[model samples]
Target: MPTIVHTIRRGWVYSPFTCEYCGHEDQGAIHMKVGASAQVGILQDYDDTRDLAMGTAHGNMEQAGDELIALSPCPACGKRDELAVKSFYAKAKPWIGSGALFLVVGLAGAGYLASEGEPEMGLLATSPLLLIGLVVLIAGLGKRLRKLPPSAVFRSRNPEPWAHLGPERASQ
Candidate 1:
């Protein structure tokens, strides 16, 4: 029986926040790492896990309008409050684990053959797989270049620019 190997990835999302003080923007990211096996009768396990992660990352930004608001100095420029009000969900990238696996297997096979005093056979046996691994790796990288949709901008009813600031700054 071919060991059924499964590659799993956790879901993640992030947004960009610009500092109001110095107009510096930093991307806020949320990632959860999860791994599991895909048994023939339990395929839904992976989906359920991934969906839960996605939901957790996508909070009610609208209701918690001030949740991301901060009064700390801008991380990039040491300023305060000039942060951009708009928040967007970050894009998702495709995983290229297969390419890496292929590369590793191919190289290991070559190394083993070389150590066994079969340099020519090792070169011939590994050359094709190495080339294929490179091709797949490039394709995977290309897929990552495409951008995914971000969540809609969280809107707030508060009109004050500093309304998102915490209560500590409210008295200021």
Candidate 2:
């Protein structure tokens, strides 16, 4: 019997960003420290767990950064600007196109093979393509229906100072 062990590791990610409203850049940048856990196993499941952990940490950092920017107004302008976040349609376009192509090619090939009395072979070869195309198409469409929050928003209830104010401004 194989024994599986789980391990947790802590790490930090440094993200440098510019203020969209005032063009102010952070010299020291923001430090996002997070922890991720992974399972040790003899199979591919270990890799998947590791990947998931890392992705979770990174995603948390990104969300934190976005919220920070949204809540804190530019020190120079005292106002916030819109952040540019990729939309669902933009991210799903490639997958959707690829799925459609796969479906079309698979269907065409299957039809041609049927005319030649090799329909069974054609389906055996193209079945994988059709299945993959259907799965990808459904996934892409599901993503298209997801509603993502706006890239930036002004939070008047509890405003905070910008993370990195320049040296001259810091002293004042």
Best by TM-score: 2
Task: Write down the worst ten-residue block by lDDT for model 2.
Answer: 151-160
Stretches off by above 4 angstroms in model 2 are 1-60, 67-88, 150-157, 160-172
Q: Residue 39 error for model 2, in Å?
A: 9.9
lDDT of each: 0.50, 0.60
Segments in model 1 whose C-alpha atoms lie over 4 Å from true places: 1-95, 148-172
lDDT of 1 by residue, 12-50 (tens): 323445666556655443333434333323444555655
lDDT of 1 at 56: 40
TM-score, cand. 1:
0.33
lDDT of 2 by residue, 54-167 (tens): 777677776665544444445456554454334424678778888998999999989999989999989998999999999898888887777653333222221223324556
Candidate 2, residue 106: lDDT = 93
TM-score for candidate 2: 0.48
Tell me, by lDDT, which candidate is best: 2
Q: What is the TM-score of each candidate against the true structure?
A: 0.33, 0.48
